[model samples]
Target chain A: MKIRVNGEGVQLKQPIQTVEELLHHLNLEKKSLIIEHNHIILKKDQHRESQVSDGDQFEIVHFVGGG
Target chain B: MLSDNRYHRQMLFEPIGEAGQRSIQESHVLIIGVGALGSSSSEMLVRAGVGKITLMDRDYVEESNLQRQQLFSEEDVKNQTPKVIAAKNRLQAINSHTIIEAKVIDVGVEELDSIAEEVDVIIDATDNFDTRLIINDICQKYRKPWVYGACVASYGVTFTVLPDETPCLQCLMDHIPNDGATCDTVGIISPAVQMVVAHQVTEVIKLLTDNQDALSGKLIAFDLWKNQQMELKVATLKDENCPSCSQAKYPNLEYQAQVKTAVLCGRNTVQIRAGTQKNFHFIQFKEHLKDLNLTNFFSNPYLVSFEIDPFRIVVFKDGRTLIHGTKNPQEAKKLYYRFVG
Candidate 1:
C-alpha cells in the first residue's frame, strides 16, 4: 500500500504495526526526527506504543543547528 | 483646546496622522523576551497607542536590569518584580488607553507559530539567539512580519523581516553562535539598548503605517559607543534554498521544545518551566513554602526565594522559578508544587 509523508507520496515496504517498527525499518532515530502522524505530535515515549498502518500519512521534521 | 491634542505633536508628522493613529489604535503587537530590548520596545509601543500589547518574558527584573530596562525603577527592583508585570504596570500608567497583557513564560517553539499569527507584528527583545531563531522560523511560516533587534556590549542591530518579501534572520546567520558571550556573560551598556530599541520601534511604526517603501533593505548594525553603522545588503539571500523562506517548513511547530526538562547552566540550580499551569504567582505561593526551612522568604513586591529540602526555590516576582536541585523535570515539578503551591 502507499502512504503520504510530508505531503509527498511514498510506497510502504510492509504493513508496519507500530511507530517503533517503522523507525527501525527507516533507520531513523527519535532524537533526529520530530514525528507528527496525521497532525498529532507523538512523544518519543509514546512512539513505541503507537501503531502506524499501511496508508497512514506522517510528517517527519528535524532541526539543523544554524544561527 | 482639543481633546486629541495629547497625540497632536505626533499627528503633525503626516505619516502617523489621524489615519495612522487609527491603525495604531487597532493594532496588536506581541513582544517576546522582556529584557533590555523588550522593556524599551513595550514602553514605546504602549505610549504610542498600540491597541493591545502582549509582553512575555521568562525572567524577573534584577538590580542590574535597572540600568538598561528604562521602565523599571528602584522600587521595582526592591520588590524583585517580574519584568513582564513591572513593564505592564509602567506601560499601563503611561497610557491607560492601551491594553497591556503580560505573560511570564518561555516563548517555546511549539507555541511560536500560533502566537506569531495572533499578533500584527512580533518584536524581538530577547537576549538569546536560539529564541530569536525560533521566532524567525515561526514568523516566516505564518507569513507574519516581525521586527528584529539585538544589542551586545556597545553594538546594536535592528531589522524588519516580512517573511517571503525579504530575507529572514536565518539568511544572515545560518548557525547561531552557541558561545557563552551573551549580555549576561559579558555585560551590556544602557545607551546601546536605547539606540537599538529606538531604531526597532521606528521600523515598527513605519511598518504599521504602511510606509513599506521606507522599510530597510539591508541588515542594520550600529556601535553606539564608537558611533559607527553597517548596513549589509542581503536581498539576494532571500531564495528557494532557505528552508524557512523557500521550503516553508516550520520546524518550531513540528517539534515541541525538547520537554523543557534540564538542569540550569549553573549546576547548583535547575530551572523548571510550568507544565500545566502556564501562570504561577510567587507572592501567594511563598506562604505555602514558609513551612520549609527556607534560608529566606522575602517577598514584598518583586522577588521570592526559599530553601526546601535538598533544593532552593528562587522565584522572581515574574512566573520564572529556579529549582536548585536536580535538573529532572519530575523532581523539579514535585518540589515546586510541594512548596510554591
Candidate 2:
C-alpha cells in the first residue's frame, strides 16, 4: 500500500487499518502534530477510533518555539 | 471622490483597480478579539476603505491596553468604554464611508456558524489559542477565509487559512498547547504587534481583493527587539493529513473549552476570566466596597476598578476581571466576591 505524507508519496508494507494505528506504527507522537486527513482535522484522541484506508492524504505539522 | 492622481497610486497596483474597489466597498469583514493586533488591523482596514467592519471584543480600554492598542487614547480610558465601541468610534471618524459595528461580547462557538457565514472574511486578532482554534473551525466549516495573526513578547506569527486550498490553524497544530508560552510569562513590545498586524492587514487586503495566488504558504514569524525574521515553510505540511481540511470535521467548534487567563510579565497585572456572565454591575457593585478605602479608578460597560489597599480590583463588566498586585487565582476570586456583591 502507498500513502502520501505531507504531499510526498511513500510506500508502506503494513496495511494500516486506522490513522491511530498508522501513527503508532510510524512511531509518530500524536501530540506533536495536527493531523488532517482529506481536508478534515482529527483530534489526537480520536486517532484511535479513526480508520485510515488506501490513498489517504495526511498533513502532519510540528511546532517550533522561537521569537 | 478620490482624485485621479490620489487613486492613481493604489489603482496602479492592478488588484485595487476600480473593480477591486467595488469589491472592497461591498465586502464585510468581522474582526473577532480586538486587543493589540485587533485594534491595529481593524484600524488600518477601516482607513484603507473596507466597506463594512464588525469588531467583536469582550474587553474594555485600560491604561495598559493604550500602549499597543492604537485606536484607544487616555480619554477613552477615562470614558470607561468598551474597546470595541471605542475602536469603532475612532474608525468611523477615520472613514465615515465605512460602516463600523461594535459587538462588545465574546465570540463563542454557538455564534460561529451565523457570524462566520455572514462575513466575507474573518480576521483572527485574538490573543489566546483557544479562540483562534474556534475561529479556524468555524471558518473551515463555512469555507470563509480568515487570516491568523498573533504577538507575544517581541515575537509575532501569522498565516492565512483558506478552506479547500491552503492549511487551517488546526491543520498546522491539532491540540491547544498546554505548555504554550504566552505574553504573560514573557513581555511583548509595541513594535512587534504593529509589524505583525501590518502583515496581517496587508494579507487581508490581498485576500479580499481576489489575489489569492500571491498568498504565501509559510508561517511568518518575526522579532523586532531581537531584529530577527523567519518564514517557516508550511507548504510541506499542507499535504500532511490534516483533520480540519482532510476529514471535513471540526472539533474546536463543538464545545466551550476551559478558560484560563494570565498576566503579562513586566506589566503590573493579571487576567481573570469568568466564562459568560454578562450583567456584572460596577456602580452598584462599588457600593459594596464602601467599607474599603478603595477609590473608583475606572468604570465602564466593559470594565471597572477600585484601588483597594495594596492592589487594584479592576472588575471588567463581562464578569472577568484582573485583581492587580496578585498572581494567584484563588486570591483574585476572594477579592471578586468581597467587593463584587
Candidate 3:
C-alpha cells in the first residue's frame, strides 16, 4: 500500500491498519508528535483507534525547542 | 497624528496601505526573549512602524550571541549589558519614533499575566515550551493573538493562535518535553532564525492590521539544510475540551506562578530566582567570594559575575542567579546553593 507523508509518497510492504501502525512501521516515536490525517489532527489517545488507507494524506509535525 | 514619510515605502504595500500602516503604528506588541528570533522579529516590527514594543529578557549579551542574535554587538558583551537593554538601544537607533520598553526581569506567570494584558499582541521568541505554554494560556485567557516561533539547528517551526477562532499550542502538542532538539544540543545557523522570524513578523503584522484573510492559518515547519518543508492546516486541531481555549482554564498561568527555576534557552544556562524578595549586591558577597579563593571575578553595582572553570555565574541585585554552562536545573541549583546561596 502507498500513502503520502509530509508531501512525499511512501510505499509499505505490509498494509498499515491505523495511524498507530503507520507510526510503528515508520519507527517514529509517538512522543512530542502531532499527527494530521486528512487535514484533521488526531489526539494522542485517538491515534491507536484511527485507521489509515492508501492514498491517505498525513502531516506529522515534530515539535522542536529553540528560539 | 504621528505623520511621517519615513514609512512611505511600507505604505505602498496594499495589504498594509496608508490606513494599515497607521494601524501598525498604533499597535503595541510584547516580545518575550531578546534572543535571535526575538531580536529579529522585533526589528522587523519596529521597521514596519509598530507603535510600541515591550522587550522582556533575563539574560545579558555574550560573545556567542553575536553570530545569530542580530541586534547585539561586541560592546554589549563587553559591558555585560542585558539582552533587552542592548536590543532596545539598537532598536531605538533603528526607529526612534517607536517606544521601546526594556525589561530585564525573569518572566514568570505573574509577570506575563500583567504584561500580556497591556499589549495588543505577543510574540514567542523564547527557546523553551515552559514559557511558550504559559504565553499560550495567557493569550488565550485574555483573547489576545500571539505568533509562536521556534528554531534549532537548520530547522524552524511557526504557528499563530487566535483565541476563539483557532486551536492553541496545547491543542497541537500533547507532551510537555518537546522533541528535545535545541540550539544548545545542536548549534543553530542564522538562516533558521531569519526564516522563523519572517513567518512570525508577517503574522504579527497581519494580526495588528486586521488582515485576517491574509493570515496563514497553517503550521509551518522547515529544515533548510535538509530541504524539507511542511505547511499543515491545523484549524481542525482545536479540541472542544481544550484547557486553554474551550474551558478557558489557563492551566499554565496557575501552575507556573510560584515556579522559579528555568533553563535559559539554547544557552546551556539555568536561572533560579529566590522564593522571597531579598536584597543582593556585589559588596554584600565580596568578602564571601574572596574567601572561596575565587580570584577571577568581577563585581558591579548591578550584578556580581565570576567564572569557575566551565561555568560563568552572574548574580543580580534581586537574588536572581544565572549559572551559565549547564542546562540541568538540579545541577545549576547545586552550584547556586554552594556559592550564591
Candidate 4:
C-alpha cells in the first residue's frame, strides 16, 4: 500500500492501519507532530482511532524550539 | 497638534493614520524573551511609537548571539550585558520617547500575571515552550491578548491569541515536542527571524490599533529555505479538553517543582535554578568566592561569573546560576551543588 506524507509518496510494505501505527511505522510516534490527514486537522487524541487507508494524504509538521 | 515627526511615515500608511498612531502611542506591550524574535519585535514596536515596552530576559549577551540577534553590539558583548539591558539601551536610542523597561529576571506565572495586567498585549519572544505555555495561561486567565512567534533554522511560526476570541497555543499544540530541533543544533538564519518578527509586529499593531478585522486568526508557518508557507485555519482548533483555555486550569503556570537544572538550547550551557529566591549580596558572594581562592571571576551589581577550567558559571543575585561548557543536566546539577550550594 502507498500513502502520501507531507506531499511525498511513501510505499508501505505492511498495512499501516491507524494514525498511531503510521506514526510508529515512520518512527515519528515519539516526536511532536501536528497532523493534517486529508485536509482535516486531527487532534492528538484522534491519532489512536483515526484510520489511514491506501492513497491517504497526510501533512505532518514538527514544531521547533528556537526564538 | 502632534509634534513628533519620527513616526510620520508610519502614520501615513492610511491603515495606521493619526488615530491609529495615537492608539499605538497610548498602548503598552510586554515582550518576554529578548532573544532573536524579542529584539526585532521590540525595535519595530518602539520605532512605530508603542507607548511603553517592558522587556524581560534571563540570559546575557554572548558573541554567538551577534549573528542573529539585532540589538546587541560588540561593546555589549565585551561588557557582558544582560539581554534586556542591551535591548533597552538600543531601543531607547531608537525612540527615546517610548518607555523601555528592562528586567533581567526569569519570568514565571506569578511574574507574568502581575505584568500582563499592566500591558495591552504580550509578545512571545521566548525560546522555550514552558514559558510560552505559561504566557498562554496568564493571557487566557486575564482575557488579555498576546502574539506568539518562534523560529529555528530557516523555518518560523506565528499566531495571535485574542483571549476568548481565538484559539490559544495549548489548543493547537497539546504536547510540547521534546525532540524539537533548536538553533543551537541546526543553526538559524537572519531572514527567518525577520519574517517571524514581521508577522508578529503586524498582528500586534492590528490588535492595538483596534483593527480587529485585519488580524489573522490562523496559525502561520513558513520556511524561507524551502520557499514554503502554510496558514492553518485554527479558528476552530480550540480543544474542549485543553488544560489552559478550555478547563481554565494552567498546569505549566502552577507547576510547583521549579526546574533545578536545565540544558540551554545550542549554548552547551546548563541553568541551575535556585531552590528559593534569595537576595544574594553580590559583595558577600564575591568575598566568599575570593576566600575559596577562585581568582578568575568578574563581578557587577547584577551578577558574578567565575571561570573553573572548562566550566564558567554565572551566578545571578537571585541565586540562579548559568553554567557554561556542558549540556548534561546531571553534570550541571553536580557542578551547581559542589560549587554554589
Off by over 4 Å in 3: A11-15, A38-40, B1-3, B256-259, B263-268, B281-293, B300-302, B325-331
Cα lDDT of model 3 by residue, B1-341, tens digit? 34567888888888888889879989899999999999999899998889999999877888989999999999988888889989999999999989999988777787887877779999999878888889999898788999989888998899999999989999988786644567877889999999999999998888888898999999899889977788888787889999888998888887543537887765688889876654555465876786776746876545678888889888876778988899899988988889877
Instruction: Write the residue-wise lDDT of candidate 1 on A1-67 in tens digits.
Output: 6777655677776777888787776765522334667756565566789878767877654322211
Fraction of native Cα-Cα interface contacts (under 8 Å, chains A and B) also present in model 3 = 0.73
Instruction: Give all candidates' CA lDDT scores.
Output: 0.71, 0.72, 0.85, 0.85
Residues B1-341 of candidate 1: C-alpha lDDT, one tens digit per residue: 44467678777898889888888889999999887788788888887888999887766677877777888989877776778888888888888889888876777775565567778888888765667778888888778888778777776677788976887776655345444445655667888888878888988888888778888765666666655665555565565677777788755445454435445432445675554554665556666656554676666555577666677677755455678766577888777667655
Q: How many clashing pairs in candidate 2? A: 30
lDDT for model 3, on a 0 to 1 scale?
0.85
| Angstrom error at residue B259, model 3 | 6.4
In terms of lDDT, the poorest run of 10 residues in model 4 chain B is: B274-283
Cα misplacement distance, residue B14 of candidate 4 (Å): 2.1
Q: Name the candidate, 2 or 4, with the larger DockQ value.
A: 4
Quote the lDDT for B51 in model 4: 94
- TM per prediction: 0.73, 0.73, 0.90, 0.91
lDDT of 2 by residue, B1-341 (tens): 55344345666777778877667778999998888888888888876778899888866777877777889999888787788988988888878888888887666786566777779999888876767878887887888988888777776778888888776787677555544445556657888888878888878888888887778766776666756565655555563566666777786767463554565333455666655555666556656555565576654545667787778877765566667787676676677667663
The TM-score leader among the candidates is 4
